[model samples]
Target: MLDIYEFSAVFPSGTEIYSQNVQHTIRSNRRTLGGSLFFDKLLAQLHVKSVSESRPPSANRGYLYPPSKDGNLEELHDKIVSAEIADHYKQSLLYYLLKDCTALDDEEAAETFAKKSHLSHKYWIVIQGLWNLDHLQFEAALEYLTHPSLLPAFPEDILRVLIDHGKLANKHLPLAYYNAVRPPLTNPDLQKSYVTYLAHLSLIQAYFFIETQPVQDHKSLFELLIDDALQHSRSDGSSNVVDELINLPLTAEQEAWFEEYLLEGKGRTYHAARDTVVARRLALGKYAEAIEAGQQLSGRRFNDINWDGIKDMVATSLGSRVEVDSVFNVAEI
Candidate 1:
């Protein structure tokens, strides 16, 4: 029942108090691998079914009625996803909300929360992406990373995370979509390539950026750009391919120089670093790591792969072993 003002006003130390209470309450519950034993019981008491449940008919559904519960998960969920929910509800309030109620059945809520978070410096999308990625929801994680609302504001690190996972997940989806979807990602914030931009000087550079957008239902513009970059680098006469990104034949010296001069931190739009992540991870049989990487540069989503009701096939293929890091690609960076 806490409003935005009261939630925001809570002292940081209040987290410790909440933790203590949760620990005290859960200490007596039967524990499981995810440490959600007590929390699940609390949710059950509220008659909120788990996301994994195979819902039955209304007449026979046990979830339709459970004891004398009056709490409405739908209403709470509505509040969680409502764009007008609370302008000031971000950060600690959100963290605590998620920590207490991990029963997020709405995927859009996570994306909207990330997009609407007030702080520009903080990556709300990443927080949700890593959480989803950990749970083997690869497509969901990728959506948070590449959500159109986040595209303009996405940082180099987030882009790297996308590339790291996207490259491998490419073949996992249908051919039509494999190339069709990406955040136009051609934002002013990202540093475009010298060969593409500097091919001319001032305005022609701007023209090139404007003219060629990633067409929907076509291969991702970045993937096409990577191909063209390698083609252009052939004239550089440098045979020394970056060993990590050896799969992609871009000259190491040129890309390093470009990243140094053109980029603020990492590869902005066209990053060889992303290519390296995909190449190295795949070559090493890091299926777990690659899947955790999220989307292929092709812009194909994790869910696009035909699961056919096998929700955790990717996880099962790896015998349920998942990466320890919230993001698999972040470690190499």
Candidate 2:
């Protein structure tokens, strides 16, 4: 049995013409052309003709036939056909067709596709493309970055690269995307160690760009650092106090309190707090303070305090011990 479908085709003149299509064969029946294929071919021919006639008079226009549009139409038809054969084939064909579409870099393309396609799929494609771009195109990157669907998939490497390139104009991108995605830190120690590194990069970028001070999301940042310290802290070993404190934006009162705490008893204050404060200063490479603190901590009264043990922990935490000797008298402190 034949099925007929009808719709109105609108013209540039603001007039609509009613049209009907007849399907003459079933899926099981042999056919010259499937109903959908026939309609797709007709549409393609009409679109190509329309585009060809719209070009302005120019020498290059002769060679600029609408073949590109026709090719895309054919690709779309093949994708639809492949989708019916297998689920995997459908995904593959769709990915291939949409993967390299430079048109998607345009605003109209983003808007149209966002409205018509499954947003999740479009977001994945755009994010993948952005990751694959060697030199990021800011506009294209922004298109995907701003897409609500894409934010959750933004990769950490891309975020790092963006910060390195000095393009993270808005601090909120990292704040928002990290909160949403929260990529697992593979190496907890390494990740914890780099908090200051990332923060310093962000600070430098902020200074260079003259951007506003980052909103001090101190609660979250400090929580992360505290967790890191607790995770890596050994009861017998010196604490990685510097890693915990350096990234923290201390208030004047807090800084003053630390200063007083470290300097209280004719330098005996630092000796008493050596295990805690020296461990921290060493983590931050505050070598001079570490030497002074270590000397006081290593005095005859505190000889059993294990100065070598403390130094070894600091070296391991910092990934190098070369500067440890310069900071303290190895024989005495």
**Whole-model lDDT per candidate:** 0.36, 0.39
* Cα shift from native, residue 227, model 1 (Å): 8.4
- Local lDDT at 70 for model 2: 39
Badly placed stretches (over 4 Å) of model 1 are: 4-87, 91-137, 143-157, 169-333
The residue-level lDDT of candidate 1 at 211 comes to 41
Q: Can you write out model 2's per-residue Cα lDDT over 1-333, one digit (the tens) per residue?
A: 100010011001222111111011111111221122212232343332212334442422321221244333343434344332443333322332333333333224333333344345654555444523332343345445545555333355444544433144553444444444555544444243335334443432222221221334333333343333333343334333434444444556544444454455222233334455565566557756765666545432222445676667666755667776556445534
Q: What local lDDT does model 1 show for residue 310?
A: 24
In angstroms, the error of model 2 at 195 is: 1.8
Q: What is the lDDT of residue 9 in candidate 2?
A: 10
Q: Point out the worst 10-residue segment of candidate 1 by lDDT.
A: 64-73
Candidate 1, residues 1-333: lDDT per residue as tens digits?
233333322222222222334333333222211333322332343344533233542422323112112132333333333433333333423442443334423334333433444433234554555444434345675666455554333233233333334334542321111133333444433324322332222223322443454435122323334444434444553323333123333345434433332233334344343444444444456655555443333332211222211214445556653432222322211
lDDT score for candidate 1 against the true structure = 0.36
